[model samples]
Target: MAEETITLEVTRYRPREDREPRAQAFTVPYRKDWVVLDALNHIKDRVDGTLTYRWSCRMGVCGSCGMMVNGVPKLTCAAFLRDYLPGPIRVEPLAYFPVIRDLVVDIEDFMGKLRRVMPWIIRRTEQPLTAGEYRQTPAQLEAYKQFSMCINCMLCYAACPVYGLSPLFIGPAAIALGYRYNLDSRDEGYHLRQPILAEAVGVWQCTFVGECSAVCPKGVDPAAAIQRSKVAGAKDWFLSILLPRGGRS
Candidate 1:
């Protein structure tokens, strides 16, 4: 018997050429184990060279080749063509982001917002780099260590409705990084930067829809991070009023 063939309907956009983005169809022969990335590569190499997308660490570690496949945000490298139902699979750039070309979306807005959250450890005292590594207990490390799994795939932002409405919302991925570091016992930015995170479009902006977490390929719980931040923010506020000296100083 001959091998089965799959058809892919990919969205294409060229600012200097097309009036707007449009879908292009490509039918290609495929093996059972070939992933979506393989199908895209097949289209690019044999079918059409104009189709554009991003990819690296095709093993799903790089988190670069994320897009909307069949109306869901997922990593192309991890999404298999065999598992998907037969027919023309629709491939488009991630949602809630500006499309730069075919399947590539402008990620600068996402990166810029990530910087606003100061996703790093801010120490009260400048710890000498020469100083030996800051040791952390198993318990302390375990608390926030899970969040370190974030690969910044940007799928969270794509799946986020808040990001669609407010591009400057400093959406899920960066906020997850914030909670990751804030939970570290050695980190001091938690209290100092609390106000910055308390903005209307900041951590409070997260409504815990769980969509971000749902589409995450790395299992990074952006929703959990937002929830924890909310709880921490409230706790800090209550303690500030209860103890005159224990508050943000």
Candidate 2:
């Protein structure tokens, strides 16, 4: 009997060689256990050495394998071949971002937004080492635990229409991460991050489309985070007016 095979229609682009991106298909032996990343690896290793894409820790933790799998943002490592059986799979770089090569999108914009949010525990002053570690109850840890699961995979950014329309939007993951830090029991940087989150391009730009949460592989609900941030921003604004001397901190 002839071996079963699957077709993968992958995007190809060489900035210096190709004027625009184009699709190139390759046939590979089909295996039920193989993933989309596995197919790409087979093509690169055996069929065509020129095929290029990014993937690491094929277990889906690194978030580097994110791509547009048949028009939806997904981690190729987790996208199984058996799901789309007996035909071609269209794979491309994540949408709403500049493609550096074939399936690699430039993430500098996302990184900059994350940096602006200050996604870290910020203390007013560092306690001396002898003071012992700052502790939190399980409930306190649970407050921001889900938001902390982001691996920077950026699938949220790709699925977000607000980001696609407005490049200046601070975006889902960044805002979610900011909200995470704000919710941390040991953090004292709410005042510092509030201005950024309350800005015109911050959480307000989200529009509550909810796609960011739908495509999250880690089940991180960034849409909820953004909305919560909006609420927090509004409360901060009201407190600033009601108590001029002692607003939210």
Candidate 3:
């Protein structure tokens, strides 16, 4: 069976050349199961070679190839043309980030925000030379496994309304990653990070529009993490007044 052709309106911007951004259209053929990545490749190869976009791991695991497809952040390789109403699909770089070019936004803002949270596990002691690997129970794995699924795709940031308003919100993805490690029982950094996690910008800024979880490809559920932090912060205040030593050890 032959595939159908569709039109894609891509936004283009060159800070060194153009004063502002402009939208350009390209028509390409596509199969029902074929993702937007196929049409982009066709347009880039047969139509315009200068178009800029990022992609890797054609599968959804890499979290690359994330772009705005008709005002929604999604992985191009996962966006099927058949999913749209009809032709004339609009493609653009993600919102809440500076556009470096067509469909390519500056990720530096996201990287810096993630770094501030220290997304990796911090330990004070090194593993013993003769010690075996760390053992984790099924329940323990279940506790933090969902957060481990984040691919750092920035889709959460794109969907987060807080990020759109305040660039310093710390956003959803990074906070979710931080929560993943903080929940690990083996991590001693949780105590040192308690104040960090309890900050105003940490997770309290999340408004829970829940768009972040809705758009997450890996089902990381950043909205839920933020909500969990909010609950914890609220409970801690009460525990401090009602209990001894502010519920500290």
Candidate 4:
């Protein structure tokens, strides 16, 4: 009996050779346990040595293998070929980003946005060594735990049309992470982060598309975080007007 096979329609782009991305098809052995990443590995190892992409920790933890699979942003490491079987699977570099090569999009913009959000625990003052370590209870940990699961895969960005149109927007992952730090019990940086979050290009640009949450692999509801941040910012703005001198109520 002939071996079963699956077809993969992969986008190919070479800066030096090609003017733009083009689809190239390849057929590989069909395995129920194989993922889209596995098929890509087969292509790289056996078929095409020049193919370019990014992947590490093939377990979906690194979040480096994000791609457009069947027109949806997904981590190729977790996208089982069986789920897309019955024919060819369309794979391309993530949308709304510059493709450096086949299946690899430049992420410098996301890195800049992430840095701008300052997704870290910030303290207004440091206590002496005599002061014990800052500890968090289960409930406190639970407050920001879900948002902290973000691996910065940028799948949320690919799913977000607002980001696609306006690269200046701070974006979902960054806001979600900033909100995560704000919810941290040990963090005293909400005041410092408010300027960025309250900016016109920040959370207000979302337009409630909701696709960011729908495609999140780690269940990080960035849309909710953005909306909540907007509410908080608005309340802060109102309080400042009433109290004046940028006072907190």
lDDT of 4: 0.93
lDDT of 3: 0.85
Question: Lowest summed-lDDT stretch of 10 residues in model 3?
Answer: 188-197
Residue 59 in model 3: lDDT: 92
Candidate 3 off by > 4 Å:
1-3, 238-246
Candidates ranked by lDDT: 2, 4, 1, 3
Query: Compared with the true structure, what per-residue lDDT tens digits does model 3 show for residues 196-245?
Result: 66788777777779999999998888888889877777787688899989
lDDT of each: 0.86, 0.94, 0.85, 0.93
lDDT of 1 by residue, 84-173 (tens): 868678889999888889999899987887777787888889779899777899999999887889998999998998888877687888
- Give per-model CA RMSD: 1.7, 1.1, 2.0, 1.1
| Superposed model 2: Cα runs more than 4 Å off | none
lDDT of 1: 0.86
| Deviation from native of the Cα of residue 42 in model 4, angstroms | 0.4
Per residue, candidate 4 scores C-alpha lDDT tens digits across 1-249 of: 999999999999999989978999999999999999999999999999988899999997999999999999999999999999686999999999999989999999999988988898898788777999999999999999999999999999999999999999999999999999999999999888877987999988989999999999999999999999999998888888888676763
* Model 4 TM-score relative to the real fold: 0.97
Write candidate 2's Cα lDDT for 1-249 as tens digits. Answer: 999999999999998888999999999999999999999999999999988898989997999999999999999999999999876999999999999898888999999999999999999999999999999999999999999999999999999999999999999999989999999999999889978988999998988989999999999999999999999888877888899675744
User: Residue 188 in model 4: shift from native, Å?
Assistant: 0.6
Lowest lDDT sum, 10 consecutive residues, model 2, at: 240-249
